[model samples]
Target: MSGINWNECSVDFGEASYPYYFGEDCLDRIVASMAGYGADRFLVVTDDNVLQLHGEKLLPALARVAPVDVFSRPAGDGAKSLHNLGACLEQAIAAGASRQSVVVAFGGGVPGNLAGVVASLLFRGVRLVHIPTTTVAAMDSVISLKQAINSTHGKNHIGTYRTPEAVYFDAGLLSTLPSKQLRSGLCEATKNCLAIRPQSIAQMRDRLAAGDLASPQTLLWLLEESLEAKCSVMAQDTYEQRAGLILEYGHTVGHAVEMCDQRLRGSDGLSHGEAVMLGMLAAARISNAMGALDDAAVAVHEELARALGVGTEMPGGLLIEDVMDVVRVDNKRGYLTVSGEEAAMVLLGRLGVPLGSHDLPLTAVPLGIVKEAVATLVPDNQ
Candidate 1:
């Protein structure tokens, strides 16, 4: 933890902008930056596992500047429910939190997203700061303005758009993640490369082959790349409902598989990024079948999946029918006009070229094609 160097970048979404500071072995710098915000109190939102692992290292420093109120839920996607969100709001009020208090999101995507919604709802809106500890949060979720929790019927069904005052992370914290957790963010980054910045595919391949996936250099590279890919598309589209939707390249089907698998396995299911990677595999096949993307391009996705150690096959015990059922209610339904039997999806004509209108990066993909693509991943016995 000796080489502590920090780098700063700005995310400008036309009307608003914020700095994203990141580095290695720099938790102290993150705490110091938060202290400068000069808030009445710091409502640090996180989960049990993160609080146990990295909380002690930064909480004392944060407490030195302002009173700290911690609102924690059991660690997992399940925490992003109405019950937990309401409980967090009540606790913040009960702890004397006010408009001047700042909400600090201090963990992975789940906590970060919940905190974003909490910050937006608390006292109309409080300043929000993100100190993401996981690759998924640091590289993907925290970069955008969307904040949401799952509805009983679908993922991210209940949410709003809220930007953070700033985002900070120490790549050192990611070293503590389990292999599956560590690979999660990179998988999302892979989606960015394939969907937005296909030119970076070679660099991604080199890093994966290098086999030092958790090294600070690799993490930093992924973070920078994600920012570039996402921001380029989101700059003019503040709500991510237009061109920014390209970022959802593999998410339509990926999310359905993820939710279905989560029902069966809970937090033990495929990680979000892993599920999205599989989703991209499905998208690739659908695109190929539709005569948009060629088989060679599809092979590139499979090669990256192998290099990243993520299985391109469907998750075990998952039923294709169940996944199709979820896809029917996909969040991107209205993005394009489709019949009841089709789902709106982002399909690519080639590397870096999405197959859709200039304003929207989605097409209505036939449910039959979607089922066929997903079926390829299922075990024959199923």
Candidate 2:
């Protein structure tokens, strides 16, 4: 927090407001925040893992306010797809969840985004309270109103922007996460920090190099700063019409990596955060080639990866063409200046800044660069 600059890059998206309760016992704060709204019954939508880990705090607190029913699915990002969405809705119905009941997404991004969409769709929109479990969800995905169910076409191919009534982040829960998961979550934070507050990137690298991820206070401070940075930007473009596109800096390549890795197949594979780390590296290279990002910025990212124990390896065995296909098909590209232009051919520039509409030479980015990046990022030293 000390190294983060709040003045120059602060972005206020607009009038949209949602309660974001941070710190410990935030679950209790969630109930208190929603008490005034008067929900008679509550339906908590979560993953099996999170329900086992954190549901106790939320369910009991929610029960204090009203009758609470817990509905959970198997863990993993794949559970957020259409198949699970249907099952979740049916489960909610069986549990007597009604239009009047509040639906709380009680896990990370998958649960939060999925539950928010279900709430929006169920009975033409039920009230939603988002309780983000991971560091990334607390900051980036939880604030965005977009909810989605993936398809064969791509990730989040079917989704909408249905903002939750509130978002509660309890940094206390971050302690239980595995080191890999912690690094994964930190990828989003790193992406945001690199774009807006470059110094934050430096601070995080220093902290991680000093072995701070194991410290709850350090994680919380970093999470808070990251969330504030994103929230400020989200307030400007909740609908992602204009300024919001900056949020997609690393995501374009990130999603492609996830898609190529078949993230839907298994949790043992690359996580959303893991894929993003690879994506960020590739995007950094793109930025470098585009002349927007310099060696210094790229070095900062590389240093952070090593410090945080995040894998900087490029995903090997992945066909660049296949990954590019997913990139073009990504929803964000539709909002870009060259939607009609092939995204496979587009070179994504620096983290914060946009590269103007110029026909990028896709082949110009030698496969060797990606291969070298992959060599650096592979789980095992190449």
Candidate 3:
């Protein structure tokens, strides 16, 4: 009940901290908070779709705080690359950005990440704020300070950690999203229940089955569930290089599948949550093969995927080899040293219980086991 109103929370990331303000249709209030930043100008980092759909409302408000220079990118994960990061910084410089300029991440996770890099690099770090318009960004990405883009080899390959000036969200923006886009957050919520807080599983099932995901109440619940699950892990390990690795639940293989599928289908491919849901399935299978996860726990992953609108089918024509090729150099490698045959992965001994040390939940999953689990999800046509 009290959750529906404007709310503030502290995101204390061990080293850096910021406040997050959120509520339904609270654009005016979010903008009011930005005035305190005292920026000379705001460099709005976003994409074509968000700019077309919601920019008129946000850019005008941001301009009221300071003159706004729009640095828009084409929508999709492709926008988060080293090339775009470099281009965004160059454009911000040409736009007269300075230590007084704030890089506002004004769309989904893609633009949020792009802006994080821009803000961190420009003049060796300036102010950054997040005005997340997508559930994936609000529910998942914005919770951590890890900002990165894809390398030629794998996901999140080139990146840095930069805390934001603050983060803001208006759930109202999510109502305009297509059905396909909703899956990303839903999938992440499922991961939270399965990987971090299994007690929320029943509530999540009811929410999904009710299927009113667009309502403000449901959106609030989704955000809260994500925050409870993630903040539980991230509050201590702000960098997410240690115990917070549990938050990556299915991302290891999920990122690989998502990258390969996006190459084939572009934005129409699996949303990040869908791909990660599939990745959880693979992770569960891998765990079961190792005698860690039970059949019942594995079954829950399947149930949540179906309830959350994720099918087990891998992207058609995406070879296991291609997925493995990406997984081979998965960005999580350096966190723990494993041989060439193993991968650093987050697996579960059971729901809400990661397999490794709670301090460092990541372990070296063998490549063969990883490939076999992923193969089980491949579509028959492929």
TM-scores of all candidate predictions against the true structure: 0.97, 0.83, 0.97
Question: Which stretches of model 2 miss by more than 4 angstroms?
Answer: 1-12, 32-36, 262-265, 314-321, 337-341, 344-352, 356-382
lDDT of the structure predicted as candidate 1:
0.89
Note the Cα lDDT for every prediction shown: 0.89, 0.67, 0.88
**Range of the 10 consecutive residues with the lowest summed lDDT in candidate 2:** 2-11
Off by over 4 Å in 1: 1-4
- Candidate 1: the clashing residue pairs are none
| Candidates ranked by lDDT | 1, 3, 2
Candidate 3 C-alpha lDDT tens digits along 1-382 = 1346588888776667788888877888888888888899999999999999998888888787799999887788899888888888888889888899988999888899888988888999998899998889998899889888888787888889988878898888887998877877888888989988899999998999999878788887888888788878877788888989999889999999999998898877888988999999999999999999999999998988888877888977899999999998888888888999999999999999999889988878899999999899888876
TM-score between model 3 and native: 0.97
Residue 213 displacement in candidate 3 (angstroms) = 0.8
